[model samples]
Target: MLRVTDQTMTLAAQRALGARQARLAAAQATASSGTRITRPSDDPVGTGEALRVRARLAAGAQYQRNIDDGTAWLNTLDSALGSATGLLRQVRDAAIQGGNGSLNQDGRNALATQIDSLRRDLLATANTQYMGRSVFAGTSDAASAFTDGTPPTFNGTQGGTVQRRIGPDQTVRVDADGGAAFGTGPGSVFAVLDSIAADLRSGADPTSRLTALDAGMSAVAAARSDVGGRLSELARAGQATADAATSLEARRSGIEDMDLGKAVLDLQLQQTAYQAALAVTAKVLQPSLTDFLR
Candidate 1:
């Protein structure tokens, strides 16, 4: 049988009261701070989960920013190509009119001058830039996609790709192919227009030049289509990233955030329990003779 001594009773009461005090303090801290886990010991697993969710949220935010930049780049490409398309179409129309026998040499020369002006406009369009970076330069650091000369040479990298990471595994090209869009070197739209203008001034048939003009138009249209497709992809990626961020935020809140109603109820319950415990300990550990002498 165990000894029924006052010393043993005192120790038991102290241990019980200490435990009650700890519970009351923990509940008060939770209620005041509005957090479920005050320290790692309170909930280690939940802390780890919250950290992972936060990391995911950060990554999603970055992806969204990339999507935005990519969208802008693609839009710039589309606008430049649209302008080029309009200019090329105008040249095509003028060339058709100039090819007729009824048109006089002076009239043809006038049309040639108009085409030369449009060729300069097209050259400017080919060098379109976004954020000081050439949209048709294919990741190159060149100031312009094409050089300013009699026959503009493409300064852009042929195979280099300007990529934007829109997701953990997804990337999209945001630059246009300069060579494919406006033709590089001698076959360039600028050079082709120069040839047509020369023939018009000499009173020779301008009919042969229309084929090259149509090819230039086709190239610009194709580049614009590609840019539009990339913009659509970026739009979808942005939406997906936003949704993922939202979901991760919710998950993080679930793990770290407290329910005020439940916290308050728990605090009240602990307060009641601790007070009752103090009363019990007081009665059980009544003062001994030594206490009266002091």
Candidate 2:
């Protein structure tokens, strides 16, 4: 005859009940959180991949921010260059009018005054600041790129290029070299304008001033073109970064996120299983004197 002991029955009931409770708890958690792998142990490989993807997403976000800042800096430079070009064109017109020999000393003096004003305006444009930093000042933190002097000396260095990382392996220069755009020392655009103003004030011929004015105009135009190109590059980089971020997020969601409907169904099944196990354990563990009688 086979012997059925209370100890064996109690051990089997405890094991079955413990397993059922554990599964029920897990299902409830999954349903509430709406995630299949709440802990790394649930899916170690997926967790590792999710970590790496999250890191890349964070880096891409930072790159996008850098691109935005670079774009703003380039826009500021473009505006300053446009303003400088307009001033130079006005100076060219004034030079043309002053070159006429029919104009008297008073007429020449009036043109000189207008040129001086325009020169100051151009100087201001060269020292244009964006977000409290000079746009043409390279990496220098100076309030202005040029000093308020006779020739408007360049206080900022051209060797330092303000660059921004827009991608994993890409960086773009956001600042213009003031020395290249406006020249430096006696050959600077400010110096050229000052000299023209002095000549006009002294009743000198305006025909000689046209050459310098044209050269300055050419330099400003080139700088504006460079800024435009960088703005376009930043736009493309921003779009690519955004697309990459979206892809990474989708990949991460696949690994981390869970289906709410499936989780709820699983929870319901686990609850029913747990209740059935409890009822079976209650019946099996009930004392039956038949074993002792045997």
For model 2, how does the per-residue alpha-carbon lDDT over 41-92 read when each residue is reduced to its tens digit?
A: 9999999999999999999999989999999999999989999999999998
* Model 1 poorest ten-residue lDDT run: 285-294
Model 1: per-residue Cα lDDT over 1-294, one tens digit each: 977877787788889889989999998898999888778888999988887898888888888888889888998898999999899888888877888877888899999999999988998888889989998989789889999887887899879999999888899999989999999777888888888888889988877988887888888888899888889899888888888888888888888878999999999999998899899889678777887576
TM-score, predicted candidate 2 vs. hidden true structure: 0.92
The global Cα lDDT (0 to 1) of model 1 is: 0.87
**Model 1 bad stretches (over 4 Å):** 1-25, 101-103, 274-294
**What is the clash count for each candidate, in the order shown?**
0, 0
Instruction: Give residue 66's error in model 2 in angstroms.
Output: 0.7
Q: Rate the local accuracy (lDDT) of all candidates.
A: 0.87, 0.89
Q: Return the top candidate by lDDT.
A: 2
